[model samples]
Target: GLIGKQPSAEMERKYSNETQVTPQTPPAFIFTCQDDRAVHPDNSIRYYQALMRNGVPSQLHIYPKGGHGYGKRFTFPYTEQLQYLLTDFLNEQLSK
Candidate 1:
């Protein structure tokens, strides 16, 4: 039988809470948007800082303005910025 799965409220809440807890340390790139309203950008900022403090190779970009769901549908100065960030991260990771 094909089973349809939907996230239970408990699961959803757990995931949401987990997002708030920054990783102890991250060894790779971390990307975050400053103007993101849905998820406070501070979480990413703190995580990136933690990575930096631990001597991990990481970078973060905080756009002046780019609301949530900016995905590829919107065009703003940050769009180009995010593109370059992604490209750079890929190159760095693949080179290793």
Candidate 2:
């Protein structure tokens, strides 16, 4: 599986995008599922935290359910709510 395939030294460069974030980074919107097994929800948390720490405007939504790969389509109880919230965030951010 992809998780078992740890990057060799040469491929270590292909990794998380966290380090690329900076104070000048643009605003961000992040979300994740608490019950997602394929991906740890904290990835979103960490990035959101980083964005806040770096002074970038951001919004994060961690649903109590909804697993990985929720994407743009409808899924789970809170999917539509999250989408609406995301839309609101986008509108607010883009307006400023």
Name the TM-score of candidate 2: 0.79
lDDT of 1 by residue, 7-90 (tens): 777665555423434444434555556777677777667666666666667777766676766776666656776778888887
| lDDT by candidate, in order shown | 0.63, 0.77
Worst 10 residues of 1 by lDDT: 17-26
lDDT of 2 by residue, 10-85 (tens): 4433455455678999888788889988878777787788788889998888888778887854757887787799
The most accurate candidate by TM-score is 2
In candidate 2, which residue ranges exceed 4 Å CA deviation?
Answer: 1-14
RMSD after CA superposition, every candidate: 7.1, 2.5
Worst 10 residues of 2 by lDDT: 9-18
